[model samples]
Target: MKTPACRIFLFPAMVCFSIIFLLSCTGQKIVSLKTLLMGMTDRTGITQTPSPWYKLIQASSYDRKSDKVGGKGWFANDDYTQFSGVDSSKGRKEYILLDSDGPGAIVRWWMTFAGEGSYDGIIRVYIDNTETPVLQENALKLLSGQLLAGEPLSASVSPETDLKMRGHNLYFPIPFLKHCRVTIECDSIRITANSRKPSIYYNICYRQYEKGTKVVSFSKDELLQNAELIKSTNETLKSSGTISDNLNLYSSSEPISAKDSINVNIRSKNSAISKITLKLSAFDTEYALRSTVLKITFDGFQTVWIPVGDFFGTGYKKTTSSTWNSRVDDQLKMESYWMMPFKKSCSVWLINYGDQIVKADLNIESSKYKWRSNSMYFGASWHEYHQIMTAGAESEGGTGKHRDINFADIKGKGVYAGDAVAVFNTVEAWWGEGDEKIFVDGEPFPSSIGTGTEDYYGYAWSRPEIFSHPFIAQPSGSGNFHAGLTINMRYRSLDAIPFMSSISSNIELWHWLPAIINYSLTSYWYVIPPYEINIK
Candidate 1:
């Protein structure tokens, strides 16, 4: 059963109202675009679970036939042109993409289209019980950085990708108070499998707040009001490697021989790690990148264990990419900007498991942080499956023996930050037909399930062109359609999932062909103490 939204808020209704009034003289707190944009870069905000926490929900164009577990058409591939209902009350028909009652905010919108005349439709967003649409623009232009906010927040992946094959994405937050409806007025849409009309695909992620929570609905006026802040936020996200002057830096250079390790310890009383950078040199740089493991212990508890490459989003290769949380440069220097809080002490280690000696230069930055009740320690976990075999999906003529591969099974209260996957395909066939299935707080069914692996990574059509953004990136895509290496990563801010107890994340290994492949997953998160992580 779905977790009731009422049970998520522990405080009394009066307390919720009090907090809102504290933010403004106007009795209700306005969750404006500025409020959400500022929250995106606030590292400390994610640690403290909100008093009236919001649940992350996803509305996607997944195959409707997959509604029941172990039912027929569970693995159907017709994930396009599905609608909630058709609204024709206004004299013209509008296909409903999403209709929900809200004290909520839409955080991420990813879409793509195929067939003829697909990208010409106008997308309308109606909010707060208003009959007039707050936003009405060409669907492609609105999502692909042409209509609203520009690059990173609103973007299409891989400039090298063919225009029609690219996945358009918008990360700008769209808050609503009473209700929100998204519809499309496209005459070219047809539901028939063989229809010549365009096929639309989408995955919309939103946050549903508890009832009675005050939220300011999105509008053109709000967008105009927050224009300057939006630009500043985009700048900050783009320059994630900028070091803050407030932080104290600790630098070290050491050579670790085969089967050896080096450590850096910070014994500050009330401090947090603001940034970490590491550069490695070896005879075989690629092998060293994969074999050298980065391990971190916060306040006596080990919380992070992953390879240097995967942890930094490069995945065994020194590919250049940048995001709000992590980045890799042309010189192969990798930096991580996750805020890791500690009460008294923190320890970081780099262990070389390979035969070659590796030289490492590390830079650690820390700043004063006040310990709070909701403070959480940052964590990351990674594992690799060698020579894993995949059975083709039945839709493509092979046995549909796809299986869910666990990324991370975290036990304890925490917020899921982000994840990255590296694949080494052994054949030149599309290997990412899988969908992400994430279960939070021991829910009977996954609260967040995706349409496809590529869709979940904010891209579409399995195009191999490389792209980079502040939140999502494909550092390398050679393996996406051929037998090579591919790396896909996604970082979260507004859409970060907070679990009161546990989170289990899995992605189906739905390869298109029966082939052997190498797959590795790295998951990033933050959890309170007394936590257990299944990946080691």
Candidate 2:
């Protein structure tokens, strides 16, 4: 009995409704930085679903397990898998950087050549186990964020170019449905350096999806299609458009005496915190900032306990600068952009353990959130040691028993986001040789083990230079000898580590000199509520 006009309108309506229903049934949408930030806010407030759920993972060229502080007997065997030299006879073809089977995406890549003759190397990328490489090109051009004829891909390349050193970084997202294999042929390559020999230093940062995740394999055509989108997103980021829509809640805390703390409670249903910033002024700003502790509880459970400076990616009492998820300015202002979701209520406080009265300025912003059962509350923990000694085969205690500094130990389902570390070196002969071991879901051995401390922070050769990326930064470095402080931070976007039951993240305190070194770290993660966190 419907009119002909009704059919015209009803047909389109039915198609639109069906499309929306299908999308809703398909679960979370896979979004990149560009898609996530587009129209995320309105006149009323920010949107409910700006960020999609994803966990970050890193695959690097760490030396070997035997190099661990406590390996003994069979465990001390050498395992050199990161890079290889040019086979004089066959050349360095098929030099694999990453080989994994998954529904995942490679989010970032970095590489640097040691010695000489590496710029002319060829890079090959094979996706889904295809017999032929999906991409084959010059290593120098590809890593330097350029296409044919040196056209810059600013969205991808974030590098360090000094007179003595050159490092390449790439950030193009390469999604795969099945398998990913990357290799480099270094034989034909030639570096500008005067040396005759050359080696490779590289890092592969990616995100592993759930078993049933549907992903589109990356292709050259797809990259071209996303070219304009990527450029637009980069422009938005450069102009600081993504965060302009947030509602900032800022307050200066009442003067608190020594050993006293002040609490700020915010109650709202279906809301998520987007950012937090703080600055302090005191008689002894350095000691007071170090002594002050920040505690945050959400939905009736305590989640964060860290020093004010460490929580914001700085070593207390030191002048530092970095640009990432967290940053500390020269004027001592600290800022963080870790998104935190809460359904009911949240409480935060700062306790001054120092002697003088400490004045604090705080700002927190919240946005509309529709938290699901799988959504987890954000958590952070801090740990430090005044002096940790290096380990040798016969030195200190047993090798494996030499306690690795614990970044986090959690029970229940969660994702490890990232961390900031403050290294106070007493003797500065490369204190970052230690490896990272991340054990997930009750695994006896760490599932994600790193090559070196510097490598884990997206750099090479333990250089003392400042470099910042969207996800990682070395804000402060040991300048002259090794007597100063070095603070490093890494924030994960598409590469967060996920665990179903439990996870324990530790970094080997393998220093260079026998002298004691100070190590402090603040670990960040997200977990289902009603869980326990142990940090030592």
**Alpha-carbon local distance difference test for all models:** 0.84, 0.65
Candidate 2, TM-score vs. the true structure?
0.81
Output the TM-score of candidate 1.
Answer: 0.93
**Per-residue error (Å), model 2, residue 101:** 2.5
Task: Choose the strongest candidate by lDDT.
Answer: 1
Residues 1-536, model 1: lDDT tens digits: 33121111122445445645675775554676778999987777776666457888888777787786546765666677777888999987798888889999999999999877788777888887777777777888778855668777888987888888899999989988889898987878766655425788888888888887777667665676678888888777777764555688888898999999999999998789989999999999999999999999998999988999999999898799988888899999999988888999999999999999999999999988888988888899999988998988666676887788989999999899899999999887899988888889988767787788889998899988888888899999999888899999998889889898999989889899888899999998989978888886
**Which residue pairs show backbone clashes in model 1?**
none
lDDT, candidate 1, residue 522?
90
Report the C-alpha lDDT of model 2 over 1-536, residue by residue, as the tens digit: 22121011011434434544565577856433233223221211111211343445666655543443355521321212354332233343566678778777787676766555556567777788776667777665566545521222222222443522544666556777689877777654443433224566677777677676655566554455456666664453333112635464746557878999988888989777777878888988888778999998888888899988888876675565544356677788887766777889998899998889998888777777777757788888998887777553334333433347888789987877788789888764666756678887776656566656776776666777776656666777773137888887776554567777788888877654565778888898888855778873
Q: Which portions of model 2 miss their true places by more than 4 Å?
A: 1-57, 64-70, 73-92, 148-167, 188-197, 236-250, 318-324, 392-403, 479-481
Task: Tell me the deviation in Å of residue 199 in model 1.
Answer: 1.3
